[model samples]
Target: MYFTFRQVQYFVLTAELGTISGAATAARISQSAITESIRQLEEQVGSALFSRHARGIALTYEGHRFLRHAKLIISTVKDAEDAFTAKNDNVAGNLRLGVTNLVAGYFLSDILARFRRVFPEVSVEVVEDHRRYIEHLLISGELQLALMVISNIEEQFALSVDPLMRSRFRVWVSPKNDLADKSRVKSSDLRDQKLILLANEDLLESISGWLQGEELIDQVFLRTTSVEAVRSLVGTNTGVAIMPDLAFRPYTLEGDRLEARPVEGLSVTLDVGLVWRQGSPDTDQAEIFKTVARDYHSKR
Candidate 1:
């Protein structure tokens, strides 16, 4: 039986979100449309795709069987679209990019500057968010590409990741603060001090693990999701924050209101990189952007 792409998309969205309403919102369609589409699809298959429960829906056995193939079909369609779009030399197309704050602070401007110079007609849009959210966007086709801290990516199975540059973490505080005299503060030294950090779950978990190893888990004071918030909090001398050095340089040097010192044995540095769906089209503009990013970082 022939299955349409829309049917698979509706089916997958419903399955993933576990409710027709949720799926409709995600797919940007009305609930009745998704309901009818799924009904038609189930009729074609002659088996129950989902079992409706009080809370939501669960995939039936037949649904599980079809989902794997459905994902492949969607991926193939996306690859075809990317390939066709990548054919243009002028790069006169929309490029949706997702980036974390650090990438936005350090790498984005240079990349955008170079890309704009090369492809003035190309429209570029950027969404700044944490790593997890960006990855979600990449998988959902909401973002064409993303730049993030690479230490968070555990596997490269379905992604093409290109190493852009390496950066390390450091403990930041107002230079006038008492800790500035030390070359590097130890984990134990931080125990009595109020610690601030970008409220990333993975980063928090990583720090928690390190603190636990050092038996200093109870010392954190402020945890925020915004890096700018961390900076503002730290700038006000509310607490000391640990952040990637790349992001703190400008503020540390120019803001005279704050300072950052190396934290010895903290092991918080990160390798920043770019990621896109594996097997996506590689166009000349994309290649040029990579080259420009590498060259720009190399000089710094």
Candidate 2:
């Protein structure tokens, strides 16, 4: 047999008050609601909990026995809720987090700085890698949190994701590139053009899957693991690349300017945010870091 918390609450209150009307008064609910809950609870247990009287009610032997267990259950639930809700003075703990290479370069510095200022006692350990690897570490419980591009996060983690920012996906082209004169470019416009991709093999594979229908994908000139290489290629008119607007720098290391054109006819965006395992609640130290990240985005 199964019962609900509300049913248990009504059973306990009715037992204490000895009357449905009195229970309703105590619970701030309709008298009929209290009666229904008690009836359902008794149905589950397959026994009448109380014997009716002219004035009120009296607990049967079964009622007395169940009352003890009911109180224990209620108390345990209260303790569990308190554990999650209660404020703790000690926020000192090691915060283990993961970030992708892109997030580490463009997003993590501000959040980490704010977190350190607020929770100096908390030690932070971070790992930076490709998004897929970061998610792997997170799901394996090797990381407490992951600050990465939260859009379309792999379902296997069953994570609790809170979006912090949405950065527009843009294409970086050289001034000499034909698209440089236009304010925007389309996926189809990439045809016959050499492209530079910055990612690990898995990411490249994913991008390739999406672009498989496009024949120009064969012309992907450089498959570099370095972001700098992508920037240098785009700046020197060597090739064009697509990335988030957060990564756009007008000038490269060699002082050559790069052109960023928004991608049209597509809903592509980088949804950056904090992600933690669902049901596995964050510790106080990690909670502080999450708050800092949230506040940093809100301010921006």
* Model number with the top lDDT: 2
CA RMSD of each candidate after superposition: 18.7, 22.2
Q: Which tens-of-lDDT digit does each residue in 64-183 have in candidate 1? A: 767757765665565455445554465576778888766777668755765565556678788998777788788777777787777777546867798877666778886656787788
TM for every model, in the order presented, reads 0.61, 0.64
In order, the Cα lDDT scores of the candidates are: 0.73, 0.77
Segments in model 1 whose C-alpha atoms lie over 4 Å from true places: 1-89, 136-142, 250-255
Write down the TM-score for model 1. Answer: 0.61
True-vs-predicted CA distance for residue 246, candidate 2, Å = 2.5
Candidate 2 lDDT over residue span 1-300, tens digit each? 999988988898888778899999999999998888888889999999989989888777678778868876775565455445645446787989899767888889767865665556689998887777787777778899989877657754477888899887578988888999888787788876788887644344335555565555676878888878888989889889877777776667776777788766545566788987787865877787787687667744
